[model samples]
Every structure is written in structure tokens, then in C-alpha cells.
Target chain A: MSLDIDAVKNIAHLARIDVSEKDLETYTKDLSNILDMVDQMNAVDVTGVEPLSNALDATQRLRADVVTETNKREALQANAPATEDGVFLVPRVIE
Target chain B: MYSNWETVIGLEIHAQLSTNSKLFSGSSIAYGAEPNTQANEVDLALPGTLPVLNKEVMNLAARLGIALNATINKRSVFERKNYFYPDLPKGYQTSQLELPIVEHGELFISVNGEEKRIGVTRAHLEEDAGKSIHGAAEGCTGIDLNRAGTPLLEIVSEPELSSAAEAVAYMKKLHSLVQYIGICDGNMQEGSFRCDANVSVRPKGQEELGTRAEIKNINSFRFVEKAINYEIERQIDLIEDGGEVVQETRLYDAEKNETRSMRSKEEANDYRYFPCPDLLPVVIDDSFIDAVRGDMPELPDAKKARFVSDFGLSDEDAAQLTNSRPMADYFEAVVADGVEAKMAANWCNGELSAWLNKEEKDVAESPVSAAMLAGMCKRIADNTISNKIAKEVFEGMWNGEGDADAVIDAKGLKQITDTGAIEAMIDEIIANNAGQVEQYRAGKEKVFGFFVGQVMKATQGKANPAQVNQILKQKLAG
Candidate 1:
């Protein structure tokens, strides 16, 4: 089964997207097509095959544990929506 | 009937690896740093940034896995757990889902001197989230990203624990192991080592389990025990009143000693886990594992065994001496100073331990250094100070007088082990206490004690007790 409009709306809400009602139908149709492709891909049975974590045959690089990062507060926090007392401020979230 | 209910407990401990830098970023992992100062482009989750794993984290994880007798998977993958929170600048946390570094380990815990084995389900590497300082602003929370991207190994345990005491034992054992292996600091106050407990109750002999409530962020061992017991009793009482316990995340109110439902965290959605495309899988070869094993420090159990066999110490004394690395080092240093092994163990496990317990200080913070203690213990071993005189010398040393020889010389507390001096003192006592001597000759054997006391008192209580006793015995017999 493909995704429905209501399901798409709930997902958009969870993602904090401003999906208008008109766009909801389009997103539902578009998402359904993507799910249909995924379903087709899942049809192949590979029970004993190990799951692939990466496409590359190489492993990850390891870095020495050292303080290479310096205080770039002025440059980094320049992109934040709000900051004060050297911290990014947001609506209080308890727990 | 209520007592028959079986409680199952499993703990998830998040131990921050004692690395110099963050897990994926080169940002300093030092605590109490000024917020965003430590956050670099990678830690800030900026676009077009990639992550490189810290080699120390893997080595520490391998050390812990080997210490716990866990299997180290050759290949482990990191996944992104999608969630939204202000403190988490990135919309997802990179964690291990399917393949973790360590798996299927077991550790032993002693509860009331009875050891029990608890299974370690798995331990995975993950980055820590930033701290959310609530009410720091008007109707808002201030986020400190200093702790963000810090390396943490989340250790999950099997639900085999039955009681709160057993749960505490398991937590303590894990804590000591992490600290002993030098992977974690085991500092709960600083949030280095944190615990979360999954507790549930079921009817006796029931094959199925009741719904579990997860108590999150229990920072202290005592708090873990208290919180688990409270949750268990609450579940039992709720079921007894025909209520069903729902699966939820609970917050421990340490001030009230209760676990309350955190409906907000519960409302959070499911974490969609997918392998991170930005980072490749971690593949540890045999050489890497061997290197980690070689770097592993001696664990507590092995140290304890060595102390017993090498030093001929009793099991209890060995346990007490090797309870911590610093204490064990002190014990060894004292013995290395030519003190008898038994005497050093006695002084270390007896006097030093009692003093530490009373003053509430760790051996690392002891005012007496190992060399200083060894100096004092040397005097007792060589009979420079008798056992009784050594106490006075120790008191002087504790009061900052000096080391054993200094204190003994400064206070004139050195034992008079000279046989000739002791004989002269005994003769003087016999002549002065003629009546007591007569009583001793007339079969009043207790009079011998009076003469010995006179000798000790005449010497200002510094007479070698053994020598004094022998001389008094010979004089009284004559």
C-alpha cells in the first residue's frame, strides 16, 4: 500500500515543514511513487547476505585525539537564530 | 503475595570516554568550557562537513570489551538516529544500531559477599548531546554545545537482575571496571558516567514480563538503588489495585526519591535509524585489536590475585588493598621500602584505610605520599620503633612532625631495644619495688606485670615491650 494524504500530513508536521493543504496531495502522490520503487527493490530475497554499510570498499579514517579546534564563537554563532551568554537560546524544553 | 512478585532490571550506562578530543571532531573534550567555543564546524553539523573517528575511543572501547570478556566485532557501523531537539544542533545523533563494537560480555558483581554474573548485552559508541540549561532565559532554554560530540559508550545489560541490591551491585561492578580499564572517569557528579534503568515487575513464575518503565539519568549508585526500588514498589502497588503499568520514560526526582512519568520525552517520535553516508564503516583488523589488548592496563581481579600470591596476603587484605589503583600502588610502594609484606598490608589495610574512611578522601588525595608512608612503615619493620612506639611516631607524622625517623628522633619515641639498658631498668624496678618483687617470688605472678609497667614508664613508654617482658620474666623467676 502507498502512503495517504493524512499520513503525509502527519509526517510533514513531524518534520516541522510548512506543508499547505494543496501541497499535501502532491507530496502524498510523490511519496507513494517513492514507496512503490522501494517495494520493488525489497522484492529480491538476500537472506544470508550481509547488509552493506557503505558503498566504498575502504574503512573510515582515524584522527588523533588532539585539540585542533579553537574557539570560533563569533564565526559559528553568526548563523544561529538567537544566542545570548555564549549559548544558543531556544524555547524551553523540559526533560 | 506482593513479595512474591519478581522484578527485572537492566541498566544502560553511558560512559564518556576519557579522550582528549571529541568523538568525530577535534574539538577539545574538556568540561566546563565556555559553550559554543568548543563547537567547530563538524560538531555544529554545518553543511559539507565530514566526521573522522578518534583512534583513542576505539582503543578504549576495545580495552573495555576485552576486560569484560566481550566479543569485539571486526566491523561495526555507525547510524544516524533522527530526532529533533534544541540541544542537538544536528537533527540526528550518530549511533550504532545493527552492528556495535562490543557484544555479549559478562561481569561479576558481589552482593552481600555473594557474587553473581550479569550479562552485558552490547556497548556502542555514540556522541553526547549538548546541555540544555532551562530557565536561563525568559521562557527559553540556553544550550551549551561544549559537551556536544563528546564520545560516549552506551553499555546495555541483560535483564537478569532480580532485586534493587543486585542492580546496585551490577552498576557498581560496571563502574569499577570502566574506571579500572581507564576508559571512563566514573565521575557521576560531572556526568562522565551516567545510568538509566529499565525496570519491570511480573507475577511469580510468569513466563511473560509486565510492561517496563525506563528510569532515565540516574546519576548516583544510591540513587539507582532507590529509584529502582521505588519504581518496583510503585508497579506492584499499581497492579495490586487493578492498574496496568504502561511502558514509558520516567524521570527520577532525587529530591523526592520518586520516579515520575516524563510525558514530554514519551511524546517524542520513534527514532528512524539509518547508516550515515558521510562516514564509512569501522573495520578493526587483528593488529588493531592486539594493539588495544597490549595497551590494556591490569584489571582489578588480576591485581587482587597477584597481590595474594606474590605477597602472601589474606584474601580480605588483598581485596581491601586492591580496591582501587591508587591504594594498591601505595601498598606496593610501602612494601618496596623493605617493609615486610604482611606488615605493610596490615598498615595499609588497617590504619591507612581507617583514616581514609574517616576523613572521606580517596587514596589519590591522601596527604601522606607512598614514599612517606613507606618511610614510617620501615621503622616498624626494623624495630627502630616498637609496635606501640610506632603509633606515637605515626601520630607525630600525621600531625606534620615528619617521617618516621624524624618523628621518632624529634619526639624521642624510638624503642630501647638494648638488652643491657632494659636489664638496668629491670634491676632498678626490682630494687625500688621490693615488696612487689617479694610478692612475685612468693608466687604472685601478677607482680611481674607491675615491674614491666615500671620499666615502660621509666623509659617514657619507649621500652621494647618484648625485651622488657623477657627481662622481667627472668628477674621474677630469680
Candidate 2:
């Protein structure tokens, strides 16, 4: 699939990024190249191989269901841009 | 305008696990906490933090799968679904994309005495996002991360439900199943369990499915049915007007009882998914699955069957009693206390259910204990109190007057079984009600009931009704 400037703009908008007219062409080319390389991997014919979902063929390590962490709200939220009444504040999300 | 249309629906339920901690993090999973207080560094996705799979979550998921007769995948992987939302601090949700933990499960639900088997496509584990509290601040939103990392098992069902009632029945059955297995608290108000319904309509006998609109976050069973009905009518109306149904997400307005479009499909988030790098694939051995199966509780279906065969309860009564584990347990406890199974079933489902409904209480929080109910049933069996007087005694028990005997004694509600006293009362009634006695002797059999009623009134409703009937028949014949 080929990428166009409009598609790139839409992708940018979906990613919550602002793309200008001048930057749109550049982003389209870059994203197209990335998609082309992924297309190259798709073109290789593997008749009988099972697809792998993870890099390593290992099972997940399970942890006991216990609450070992205590409340660190003060330290954790220290770097937040804004907070009020123990909640993080952001520009209003209507939905 | 909609006579030719057939409504089709499917449901996706999200049940929050009742584990003590968050799915991957060590943060407490308690609800209604101070904002962000239950969230730890790991839950916030801070740098250098990683997620570890909680063992209890897997166990609970397997338990649910087994209860539904679903195939438990021995191996499953977690993938990151990338999306942008303020509540999602990680910029992605750790969920199962390809291989869910459970799949192809089947559950049977009955609507109007007709049973339908709804197929479960899959159930996968995922982390819940935080809450975006809109209008909490002026021109801003407050975010509570306390629920951000809680575990949720998203159960997807096949689109085989034909009507809103069937969808509701399926949802209720599934809700009770999860609660039966002790995996979820099933509290809709607190959002412990929630449903998203996918609805569409097509011309009758049409094989091709119509585009479906998903109504999201319907927290209660009643709303689920209402939302689907509204969506179905809307689709049928649109189609009849020569308009097409656009696939989209809708929100049900509970107050208005209508579904409104939330977002169209074209503008929906892509949710680019990839296997999560931080967590490894979850692999379960035979022993783990066995352990889950071994510890599984008697599910609803099995309990219903047992209630039927063992207790000789009617099918409807058995089904109703086994709707929840607590009700089934209460019934069993009453029967185990030596009350006849049929009587226990009747009182438990009849009087107890009615009282519970009237008082707006759950069977679990019933004021009358199972033993106390059993005691009352025993009094009825032994002719200590008539059924009518037993109701009065029950009212006293509910008001905390005491157990059956105490209530019976305190309220003078015991049935008088003495033959001589009843005979004297019958004689007095025969002497006083000469006209009625003559009417009764002259082929007016109905007047006997009047004599019985009079005798019962004289005894203040304490006469054993069967004994009164026999003596009144014998004395009047003489």
C-alpha cells in the first residue's frame, strides 16, 4: 500500500500530533518507506512456518497475587504537570 | 414500517476480577479510594517499571472458563493496543489480541421457557483505564487513576441473540456465572461488571448480517435490554426510510431511554496492536488447569439439576433458586435442617422471595435466617400453626420478635389441635347456627365452610384447619 499526504495527516491527527503542510510531505515519505520495508518482510514466502507473536519463546513469569506496594501518591504525582484534590488535572475532556 | 425486520444482537461483558491487587502491579485494587492513591509507580507506567502477571488473575480466568465450559488456552500472549487518551497513561492498553485465554465457551439461557445456547467467542484479560471525571474543574477534567490497572476479563459473545429479551437473559446468566465462580463481585453500580451490546437488524430470512452499532458501557441489565430495543427500532426505521445503518459506537441515555451516536466507524481509533514487549507469553501447565478445575464450585446449571432431581423441586423453582449461589446455599441450608425439600423450596422461593422483593433486600441479607425458616416450616408440618397464622408468625420473625416458637407463643398464633375443644366449638356452632346447620344438612355443602370459618373465628384462627373440617363434617352429620 502506498501512503499519501492526506493519509499521513489523518494518522498524525489520530496520534494526537499536529502536522503542518510543509511537514506533511516529509512525513508521508518517511511513513511510506517504513511501510515498504514491512511490505518487504510480508513478501517472503513461508509455506509451513507458524507465526510467532513474541521475540522470545518463553512463558510469562507469574507473580503471587499480593499487595506489596504502599501508597506513594505524593512522590508519584510530584512530577505531574497539574493535580487537584489528589487527582491529575488536564484540559477538559467532554466525553 | 418494521414488520419485515429481524433484530440481531451480541454482547461484550467486562467483569473486573476480585483480586486483592491490580492485575500486573502491586497496587491495591480497592474501589472508591482517594484519587490516584491506589495507583503505584508501576500502575502509572513510570520509567523502568515493568508488569508481572498476577497468578490469581489467571486462576480466576480459568475458573470462569471452566464454569462456562470454554476451552482454556494453555498458552496466551498479551499485546499492547496503542491509543491516545488522557486516562490511559501508558498510551496503550495491555490486552489479548490474537490468542485469548478462553474461547468457544457455550452458555445456556432460558427466556420465556425456551432455552437458547449462546456461544462465547472469547474471554481475554486486560487492564482498565482510569476515569476521566469531566466538569470536575473549571475548563479542565480530573483523572482518577485508582482503577487504571485493575484486571478485567472481556468476554465476547457470538452474534446469535435474536431479541432484546434473549440478550438480557444471556447477560444475566453470564453475570450470575461469574459471580458464582467468585471471580467478580458483579456490582453494576460500582461498575464491577458492565456490558457493551452490538445490535443490528436485517430483513427476515436474510443470511447476510447488517452493519451493527455497538452501545457501550451499559452497566445494568434493564438498560441493556432497553438500549438494544431502541437501537433495533432505530435501525429498522432507518432502513425502511431507504437509509443505510452506519456501523458506529453509540451511547445509551438511560434517562431518555434512547441510544445516540457517540462516534462513527470512520473516525474510530485504530488501536494499533502489537505483542507487549514488557510481559512474556502466559503459559499454563496441565497441573494449573487441573487445580482450577478441582477448586471450581458447583455451577448454576449443575446446581439447578441437583435441585430438581435431589429435592424434587419444580423446574422453574429449581432454576430460580440456583440463579445465584447465595440463594441456592440458603435453600440447601434450610433443607439440611430437616425441612421437607418441597416445603423448603416453596417457602424459600415463595414467601422469602416475595418478602425480599417487598423489602428491597437481597437473599443474602435476609432478616429471616435459613434455620429460622426451617423452624417455621417444621411448625407447619407438625400442625403447630396453620399456613395463614404462619404468615403472621413470619411477620413477627421478620420484625425480630424471635424464632418460630417464640413468635408463635408470643402472638398466640399456634393452631389448637385438641379434639374436645374443637368438638365443643362445633357443637356450640351447631346449636347457635341452626339455620346454617339446617342448610348444610339439606344438601348445601358450602355452608360447611361457613361453620368452619365461624369455629376458626371463635378460636381466633388457632384451630387446625384440617381437624376443624373433619370434626365439623362429623358433628354436622350427627
Candidate 3:
């Protein structure tokens, strides 16, 4: 179940990370160690053991079906790396 | 080459819970604030700040499970999903790993008139990370902390759907259920509900499932259906050409209406998921579950059925009424004020909704109140006002002029329903339109309509339609 070194390199590349050569070897070893732990999980007899999904058994609570947020000011602003006066800010390229 | 192929589709939907606070902090869960304004020390994942589970978030997740007809897990624990992202202030995202809030549920979706039950894998609670803004000023990236730490319920569905239509149906059903349960607002435009699908294609009747790829963060039903269809075709082509589908996470490029590879899919262990040490296990008793269920409102399907049986509404009308709770309440309120169910439904779905949409308002903010619309309907029912006059009154009310009765009175829109008055007008029309009267008597019986119109015009358009028709017909015959 160990992830090959090349597969680890492919994963790092796909994730858009610049893993240096030395780090790639380290990651390959670390990831293999992790997958070995998962392999240990395959030995357990879970043929009929129900998979656990939730820790709490309670029902989901409902809120008053009202428009809590009429203004989307903060939600819209949260993603903008730059903003001013309730508007998204960007660099003036032409100026 | 007509060969057999089967497509398997599963969904992971992320819905923002309609809670007022963050899942792990007391900061307001308000959307659209200045960057980092809503963030607290905990939301920022500052040192020494331990995560606290919001009781309301857990309850909301449980309610979604119930609405999906899933089994509520008595014990669900939160685990830290280790990852690195600027948006995720917490270097590790605290999410459900071992136990989720819901399990063993089924979503019954009606696809092309055939009902199919999709398995509910799990629904769990987690906090939304902050957003990253790339390609900002001078090719630099910017990070916004405003949406950081919002509560979201990740609902995962099994790969039960086979076609694009079924996928859309399943998405819509989940959207409607969350809205009905009052857990999530189900606003797709506001990013309240988002869907991602894992799709794979295999040869027909193959017992082994194909390697599925996950499409991430598609915000609309149209995008989901398109993404699934595109992925299915892409996978089929790859298989036909002897290429194997890779297990990876793909991003849906909405602008291009296509999916692009984002990353190779990370296995559960890749994030180093372990039980969060800072947070305690979430505990729930039977009383909590019962209380949450007790607070549950009538779901959409049941409410739609009620609208049909009680209000004598058409299938379309019932569907529209139960689409949103506020709209349904407004419709019922008008009916409660003694308006005919059909008339109330018409006004709500037509004129009222039109006005609301035009003003970007909801039914709760409708200018024409239920009682006012009911009064207008009553006037027409009692023959005190013509349908045309009622429309005029409705317009006046929409302008915030007055109530229906007051508007009608101010506009002098009362109908002339008296038979004698109508008969007098009809006599005048007969005398004035002598040529038409002669033609009516000479076997052209359609001239009776002309006489009725003349009577209406002579009465200044106040003549009761039934009375005017009856008097004109009787006098024309004589």
C-alpha cells in the first residue's frame, strides 16, 4: 500500500507545491509511513461493523426562517484581498 | 460502436447552516463585512484559543439528517483535517472523521417520473475557511478573512445516481429539504448551498466500480448537471481510448463550462486526520434529539400535499406555495382572511410575486397585505366591484395608497349591479344604436354583444357584467 516515490512527486506537482528534491524524498517516506498505518486498518474484521458517521445522535436544529442577512457586505468582502468603502479594490493598471 | 457503459455519480454538498455565530467562536456569522472584522481570536486560530463546538450547529446538522430520512448517530466526534491553506486560518480544519452527525439515510428523488432512493453516506459539521483571492494587484495574491470560520454541513451522498437528470433532481431535493427544515437557507446565489460530484464510468454490468474523480465547489444546478455530463463523457472517451481515469480533485471552470484538474485526490490519511485534542467530544442525549425534532416545522412535501388537499390548489400552485416558508405563510394568511383559495393563490403567485421580484423584496415585505388582497377578492365575490375595478384597486394598494376597501372607495370603483339601472342604460343604447337594434331583430343575434358594450360605456364602466349582459339580452330579444 506504500505510495511510490514518483506517485508522491506527481501528487506534489498536482497540488502546485514546490517540493525540493530533498523534501520530495522526505515526503515520500512520510507518506509511506502514513499509508502503512492505513494498511494495518485492512486487517480489522469490519465485514459487518457499521461505519460510524456522527458522534452526536441528536437531530439538526432549525432557525427562524427569516432573512437574517439582508446586506451581503461582509460575506462579499471576506474574499477580496483588497477593498474600500464596500466595494472590491483592485490595482489601477492603466493609471 | 454501441457498447454498454454505466455512469456512477455521488455528491458532496456543502451547505452553510443558518446560524448566527461561527461554529467554534462567538463572532457573528454575518456575510459581507470588512476583511477580518468578524474574526475573533479563536476564528483566527490564534495561539491558546481552543475550539468550542456551537450547540446550535450540531443541532442543525442533526436536523438535516432527519429531513433526509437518515439515522442520527448518537455519538459523533470532530477530527482535525490537517491541510495548509491561507483561507483556512486553522492550520488544521476540525471536521468529522470517525463519527458524523447523520448516517444510513436515503434521499428519494423523482427523476423523469421515476423515483430513486440515493443513499446518504454522512452529514457532518465543520467550519468554512477564509477565502483566497488570486490575481489581484500587480499579479499579487490577496487574502480576505471575512468569510473565515463560517459553519458548514458537508452532506455526502453515495454513488447512486446514473444520469445527469437524476443528479440535478437529487441536488434540488437536497436544496429544498434543507430550506424546508430551516437548517440552511438554501440560497445558491449567496453560496449557501454548494455541490460537488464524484463521477466515474465503467463498462455496462461491470461489478467493479471505475476510479471516480471529484468535481469541487460548483454553486448552481445548471453547473452541476453540466459538470456531471461533461465528466461522464470525458471518462467514457478516456476508457474507450484505453486511458485510465485518475483519482483526483477537479475544479469546475464555470466560465468555460468545463472541469480542470486541481489536484490528485488526497486520501483520508493525507490530511493526517486525528481527533482534535483541544475540543471535547460532542455529547447528546435523547432529550436533545427530541427537542430538536419537536422544533421541526412541516417539511416541504407534507406542506405541498396539504396545500392541494385543503386549498384545492393545482399541482403547480402547490409546488410554488411550498417552495419557501415565507411565501407559503403569506398565501395561507390571505386565505385565512376569507379569500377563495384559487384567487389567493393567483394573486400570490402572479401579482404579488411579480412586485416582490421587481423590488427585490420577499413576500414578508409585500406592500399589499394578505387582508387587503382578501378584501379585494371579497368585493369581486359580492359583486360590489368588477374584476377590472379590482385590478385598479390592487394597483393602488401596490403604490402604498391604502387598503383595498379604502382604495376602492377613493377611486369610486363600486359596480352598478342593480338590474333596473342596467335596463335603463340598455334602453338608451337601443335608442342610440337603432341600426344595430334593427340588425339584431333581422336575425343577426350577435348584435346583443354590441348592446351590452354600449350599456357598459353609458354607465361609465360601472355596470355589473352579469346584470348588463342579462338586461341587454332581454331588451334586445323584445
Sort all candidates by lDDT, best to worst: 2, 1, 3
Q: Tens-digit lDDT track for model 1 on B140-208? A: 899888898999999999999999999888887788778888899888889999999999999999999
Top TM-score hit: 2
- Winner by DockQ between candidate 3 and candidate 1: 1
* Ranking 2 against 3 by TM-score, winner: 2
Position B347, candidate 1: lDDT: 78
Q: Candidate 1 - CAPRI tier?
A: medium
Measure candidate 1: CA RMSD. Answer: 2.5
Native contact recovery (fnat) for each candidate is 0.94, 0.88, 0.01
Q: Which segments of candidate 1 are over 4 A away from where they belong? A: A4-6, B265-269, B395-399, B420-460
Question: Per-residue lDDT of B1-478 in model 3, one digit per residue for the tens?
Answer: 4258988999999999998878777677777776666776677676788766677886787788778788888777788887766667677888887788888888888866677889989888888887666555454445555577788999998999998889999998888788778888887887899998999988888899999998988888999999988898888888889899988888888788888887554543277677776665666778988888898889888999999998899988998877778888888988998888998898888878878888998777788888888888898899888877777888899998898878878888889877777777778778888899899999998877777777767766788988887777778788
lDDT at A95, model 1: 60
Model 2 Cα lDDT, one tens digit per residue, A1-95 = 37988888878877789888988888888889999999999999988998787788777899999999888899988999989989999999756
Q: Comparing 1 and 2 by DockQ, which wins?
A: 2
Across A1-95, the per-residue lDDT of candidate 1 in tens digits comes to 49988788767766778899878888898999999999998999989997787998899989898989889998888878889989998988866
Q: Any residue pairs clashing in model 2, and if so which?
A: none
The candidate 3 chain B region of ten consecutive residues with least summed lDDT is: B134-143
lDDT of 2 by residue, B391-478 (tens): 8888889889999999998888879999998898889989998999888889999998899789888999999999998888888997
Full ranking by TM-score: 2, 1, 3
DockQ values, each candidate: 0.79, 0.83, 0.10
